[model samples]
Target: MDKDKSIDHQLRATWQAVAKMYNEQAANYGSTMAMAFVLLTIDKENGTPSTALGPLMGMEPTSLSRILKSMEDKGAISREKNPEDGRSVIIKLTAYGLEMRKFSKSHVYQFNNVVREYVTEKELDSFFKVTSTINKLIADKEIYNAISQDK
Candidate 1:
């Protein structure tokens, strides 16, 4: 394989390993990595609508709404109808959600440390830039599809 292809394969393998690690610990964390990030995003934004979280998590709106309902029922979050837009409901973390955030932070820090041990800072920076570019490209494709579908 070409050098670039080899590196790409390695990067994917590394991501898979990281995902497996998260899955193994998800029960202890009370959420998957994706769910944890959704909570963190809501925390950062103070609140986020269920609609927005779905797109951010790359999940269908109905599926995300179901998950959010479960979280609310579990006392991890609260959802309120957005006064300005009744069609969208905003989510806020409860005390339990805040505690989960603290736990996730430590785990994330440890994960970063492990990655740092394997890849130099400069290499990681470059890798992130490339990954971001790829994300942007994919996002644009999604946007285009949405726009086309509205016709």
Candidate 2:
């Protein structure tokens, strides 16, 4: 058994590599990977609730705020008060934003296709299983609470 190889370490390394790859590709369009992600997340038609965007993207409100502001300034997105709920806001994508979203979606699909070409069906299934297990464990607070209890 190789104790040096940890699941978290592997996940971190894989994510770092993926992020770098995305950033490199996004640079050609004069945008960061993060911006492309937000573009892709927003609703192209009906628009999305502003309060829900952060949780949907698994991002901190402060971080999301900066991205939202940048997107608004670029005229890629617009914000308006939600008619149903005046206290809340809605995020709508502009025509330019729709174009950018399509571009971002294409890159994401290309990446998945490339990965699928290399990874087998069985391996991919197992990878999803592992990830789902990890998510469940975190949601249940099994790992953290267990260790804290030991100490």
Q: How does each model score on lDDT?
A: 0.77, 0.91
Clashing pairs in 2: none
TM, every model: 0.75, 0.93
**Candidate 2: minimum summed lDDT over ten consecutive residues — where?**
1-10
List, residue by residue over 2-51, the lDDT tens digit for candidate 1: 76678668878888998878766666866777666666678444687777
Candidate 1's displacement at residue 134, Å, is 2.9
Model 1 residue 90 CA deviation in Å: 0.9
Where model 2 places Cα greater than 4 Å from the true spot, the runs are 1-4, 149-151
Q: List the residue pairs that clash in candidate 1.
A: none
Task: Give the distance in Å from residue 103's predicted Cα in candidate 1 to where it truly belongs.
Answer: 1.0
